[model samples]
Target: MTNNMKNVFDSSNTYGMAKTFVLISLYALLIAIGMHKGVKIFLYIAGISGALLLTYEWFKMDRPSIPTFFIAPLLFLIYVLISPGTFLIDARLAGRFACALFAGVALQFFFSNATYKVLLSQCAALLTTLFLGVTYACIWAPEMFDDRLILSYRNPHQLAVAGAFSIFTLFTYLSIFSKKKQLLVYCLFVIIGTAIFMTVSRSTSLGLLCAFAAYILFYRSKHLIKIVVAAGLLGLIAFSILPATQQQRLIDPFTAPLNDRTIKQRVGIWYTALQGFDEAPILGHGLRAYSDYDSDYKEAHRAEMVDKNILIIDSRWAHPHSLYLGSLFGWGIVGTLLLIGAFIPAFRHSSGRIKTFLFLMTFFSLGYGLTELRIKSDDGAFILFFPLGLAYGSILFEHLSQKNKTTSEYPIQTKPCITKILTLLN
Candidate 1:
């Protein structure tokens, strides 16, 4: 065996199984404890543990795939110097993001290893099936549910994100490698789409709509104008049949200012974030500095509004409602630029399907970020990084050719090459 191949299949490594089990275990634990308000301590512990394990594995590498993984902790290190005496925020909250980067980078290392890759594919499949089941229950038994069918999520928004992400991954899989199963994939789209509707998450709903439109426009454009006309007619017909309240829910965001308190507050929050960004233009006021300063911002807004005879009631909200602005506030201009720098090289090197997956992930996250702060939130960090890691891992596998070899422990000859089942994920 060549030295590189030997490095790829090292005795120190457990052929990706051990890494897969550890990453997935942490992911599951995050999902379970993430929604609890005061369980951040657990997340911090998980982050530190995961980081230490990955760091150890990293040291065993002879050749590490694209060093893009260094950006998160690099930014974290900068935050350490510029922190606003808020190590708790740095260690516990923003640390999830660092952990996520570690996971993604760690995942990249296992791309040539079949066992880890299968873990990711199996995970996507499991989530899709669960979403289908939840969708079925919501569609057939409306009376048994409340306004939204959240399944086990703390809120409908979480359910929506999971459904939308699963549906996107399923389609990506079909387009890239599962062409023989196109019909089955379409069926899944229908099932998952119903639950997305049930969630009533405006961000995910709108994002899904745009993604579907883009897919049809780009891929199935044989009769582009005709398809557009048919879609328009169908949309109008559907709109006419909906009840007045449902119609308003869909239409008010575009037409009525009074109906979009969410949007208005988002605008206000974005403005304040910009103001904060100006103060800490280099390194930021530190992690969650916005949270600490938000009350003062609201007071300033109320004071200004008093002169205009405007009463501000219940004006509290979370981080700036944007990926760009949230990064701007937490990491500042330099830090934000470093974060972007990390993604660019990996993106340029990625193959087609990998790029497609990453693009959709970015699109959905950015779309939602316009109205809510994700990517740093509990559920957001987990959902975002796992697939991101998979994407980076795909690039790594592409760089190194796959080969099957039997392990001494198993004695059974299973395919060592990941491509036998799923080529893209591993």
Candidate 2:
């Protein structure tokens, strides 16, 4: 085990410098994502810079290759470019998605050889800091949107999604850390969980529930029962502590079925999105198609509600509420399949721990997507793709390590340009 750990870090100085830059950029990206405002520009700059650097380093290496995980985003970008009804904005959105995937791939590729203990420790620390910042904001500079927690720039649902993702990550990676680190994660988990509840986002709550279920089913751990019980008690305590209105909001869907305006509105938006899908079943109506059919949506929404004797309401939603439905409406069945195909390679090649992590991420994303469009934009796209990229990179690294062993060949070394510069500085 010691030898294997040594082998994992045995890279040339040039590769080490590149890895340093990539890791810094990744940390920057995470900070940007967790910020409320004025940091997204940093995310864009860091993401693009990291992607470009990784691409250059990748091509400079011998036998440079693109991972199968990256192919789907590339293809999706192409489809968005040439497909009918796509505008410049649509193409731009597609470009962002592609960039995000590549960014994730780069992050993981560079960190591929690092032990989970090292990788997850950095992640846990950064995430805990972010949650602490959010917690402070919630207390000292609270921003409320419709009685739900919102940061300066993000909406309630977005905050909820971020909190949910952070919690899911900490939970999945819990077992990899030491006892002290585990305790910190538990505290961070409570902080993030309370924040999520304050967001009053039922969809995100549901997603968290689904992620927990997936973790229990697939994540092999000796302390699973203890972890589950602790989480349950924490969750119950958090819920109990929320303001009455927030608690009521969380349970509103279950307690007051007909009084849920959001549900009714979503049903209407979904109907309209599906109607658009029927028109272009193969390729859908292109990006942002849901908004284009506003008149149709309003009509369908009113008619649908009339049948149930529900009060008719006006809606001007920019995108379909559901990610799956949005994809079906905008990209159609073929494009959606392409999107799904991107993950197959990662799942095929990754280890059991990675597979479990990916499964939990996917399950949570899908569950959250049932009522929100997450991956279509920059913030949410990064949240979904970055970890996935890490998994893919690890898989590729493992494969290469094994192949080198079988052939009795030394691992390929990178050029020393960055190494030379660092040496000059030192």
- CA lDDT, every model vs. true structure: 0.58, 0.65
lDDT of 1 by residue, 203-318 (tens): 88766666666666766778778877976775576556545655677677879955566666665677778878887788676546776566686676777656644334455555
Per-model TM-score on C-alpha atoms: 0.72, 0.78
Superposition error at 43 for model 1 (Å)? 7.9
Total clashing residue pairs per candidate?
Answer: 1, 0
Clashing pairs in 2: none
User: Candidate 2 overall Cα lDDT vs. reference?
Assistant: 0.65
Model 2: number of backbone collisions: 0
Candidate 2 is scored at a TM of 0.78
Q: Give the C-alpha lDDT of model 1.
A: 0.58
Error of 1 at 25 (Å): 3.3
Residues 110-129 of candidate 2 have per-residue lDDT tens digits of 54433343334434544555
Error of 1 at 162 (Å): 0.8
